[model samples]
Target chain A: MHQIKTLSNRIRKNTGVDSIRCYQCGKCSAGCPLAGDMDFTPNTVMRMIQVEEKETDKKLLQSEAIWLCLSCEMCISRCPMEIDIPKVMDFLRQESLKEGLQNKSANHNIIPFHQSFLDMIRFTGRSYEIGLIADYKLRSKKILQDITLAPQMLMHGKLPIFPKAVKNRKNIKEIFKKTNML
Target chain B: MKKKLGFYPGCSLEGTAKEYSESVVSLSEQFDIELKQIPDWNCCGATAAHNLNKTLSLVLPSRILAQAQKNEMKEIVVPCAACYNRLSVTQYELLKNDQLKATVEQAIDMPLNTSIRILNVIQFIQEYILPEIPEKLSHTFDKKVACYYGCLLVRPHNILKFDRPESPQFMDEIMQMLGAETIDWPFKTECCGAGLSVSRTELVGKLSGKIVREALDRKAEAIIVACPMCHANLDMRRPAIDQYLEMKTEIPVLYITQAIGMACGLNERQTGTRRHLVKVIGNYFTKTRIPVENNENNPITVEEII
Candidate 1:
């Protein structure tokens, strides 16, 4: 119970969203684009955190809602209480990753995709479209998903063959190191 | 000194949205606004970083802001809606929290200055380009356009505070100035499932598919967008969108700058209109003529029209 309280407090502080302020309005879930796909609705996640039940907390972390959130801020935009639901979702995602909580749903590649994006950023100081696509495809094994579109993008000069590195990549690496992303 | 704005094109400009970069450059050139690219800027950590690490999300944008300040840039224009949102939110966060600012400053190893103004393309146009529309424009768009704001440009209203989060009209007003009959669409500020264009292509298709369908149903000739990610999702991922919709929708997704650039008598090449996956603007451009002033000294040449 103490450990759960400490975790909830940390998340509350990190996200700056007072979960207790939520009255289960369900506006966040209504406005969410991916709400239908989420295992747990945005409002339910908030409630679970507010309730601070260990089983609910575990379920919230393990649910596919964290990974499925678009973070489009639509839910908060429509929320009457002006709650930052997306921020809470962000906190949940980080927490889930930190604790190595396995996502309930199978075949969701958002985690690997996010990892590839960060990896590309760390390597080149910016996102390399070609590299990110390759890495994500390799990880997700969805090789032929957008294969047809690649030729068109290349023709339109949308996908550059080589990645452009920033002037001081060493500095970017240092920032990553300090942030413990390394 | 000439009026200049610090330009942060973000990673999308370098790849996947080169046309946006081209059109912005040409549009700025015509408007006499010097765009100084920020020196040694890194990624803003985008949607991915913020989900993984909160500190990294703030730090990446702060570093860019710090570099912009070092370059003596008072006002910065971030054309990409995603980049603008990240930078604007970071600025808002830093202004509201001193500890976070100090931590970010420490992370970046630079003195932070939160006074720099970050402007989205719509805001930039409203401030700088709208007033000069009459004199600069040689042709009117005259076609009905659905200006898609997507999600990042207008949401999280308190932090961004640019236009109305629910129904933004800055882009519509700008399109109106270009003589485009802007449609009153419902999905103007809808989410296009931005970063999921690759990870969850079907979801993007479903979300962006609805937006495209809304535009088409309302008889919008083209869907004008300010964000590169929106363009990539809506334009590049058309097959998925088409598959999801179960119909062939060929509406041209144009950057707001590209639309404005063409209205200013710039040719298709100058505005990077030829790079679109679905070619819809060619007919409109071929039909419209650049209204030339009848002056003895400044004769209208055929080359200008072609």
Candidate 2:
């Protein structure tokens, strides 16, 4: 458990609000859809706040709860204390990223997978699945990681070698040119 | 006549979500809201890209923004929540990081204008389309619905600042104007496990299942959504969720426009209600409205003509 003095002082400094308003009500935890999956429940995080223990560690940040949060703002809505639980979780995720404490689960391939998807869009002015998947596999340095899997997907007619492109790639490229964040 | 917007429809609207695009086009036409589909629009590279590379993830939408700047469409109307978030976050990053701007621009070969506004369909409707609805409403939906914003509609970034992100009533407000009963439920903007729907089925099933259960628990006749993925995951994936949870939840997850169309007295066929996975509008369409297809992608056929 976090020390009360440290938690209050941090809350006062960062949130510009006193942590004393929270009366250990579990409404936030109760309403949070991701709370059941969370390693640290909303109530626990709030309690930690009262105790003045603010741990921004890998375990805390990398936990599935951090990413699984839908940020629906339900917890705060139901909370009598009006604590922004989702915002706090977002802040923790940011701190975790800054401190390089991100959890890279086996499913961590998603991040790079997304990069490849973007790369295809950047180059072709739209999504090109074949290009994206190839880039993804290449970037991840997983040459034969899913070699057999690819054939299975192809056999199932799920994989398309020639992904569709937006008609007027050049005009789209011009749009990309103007935004400059391509 | 030309409504200036960087139109971001994401993956669903472009391909998998053809009905959403069709309805948006149909409704936009009725209101004369000229939506210039961004020339050469690309995938916003949703949940997948951001997970792989942060820069690439951000750059995907930045590329769209760059195009928007070129076209001079400062205000981007995204029909999809994931796309809206990507575009909004990219705009935030570009305004925040000059180095990132330079790199991303070089990659796409575009000079981003930086003055871009990402608006979701609901925001567009509330800001531009809703007020005009009173004049357009031809019918009324007395049915009670839970306006589910899901996760991406408003959060992290306030692109669509229509309502409180945690407790958004923007959809409810619109629903009220259209003469529908809006239920103030606890799971208004809850996550239906949208992003993980493709990658993690069981997890998304559980998440989506819970959202439906909440709506059913609240006795909402339907769930109105702005995000297509939310519609798909919650509505289309209901059977799986039902099996997983071992409960029969026949709640119809409707698009905000679909409900609005109903209230406005648009034909069920025109609103594409017939194409919905779960039988929606039940027997309501028979006595009130005739079926008509507003085929914007093609021409309106006589058979489709009501």
What DockQ does every candidate get?
Answer: 0.82, 0.20
Model 2, span A7-87: residue lDDT tens: 346446644555567788788888776688767787776566565444543356566565665556667667776766655
TM-score per model for chain B alone? 0.93, 0.89
Tens-place lDDT per residue, model 1, A83-109, is 888888888888888888859452358
Q: Pick the candidate with the highest lDDT.
A: 1
Model 2 residue B135 CA deviation in Å: 2.9
Q: What lDDT tens digits, residue by residue, belong to model 1 across residues B159-208? A: 88878888888888888877789999789888998988888888999999
Residue A164 local lDDT, model 2: 62
Off by over 4 Å in 2: A1-32, A38-163, A166-182, B1-6, B157-160, B285-306
TM-score of model 1 vs. true structure:
0.94
Q: How many backbone clashes are present in model 2?
A: 28
Model 2 earns a TM-score of 0.70
Residue B160, model 1: Cα distance from true site in angstroms: 1.0
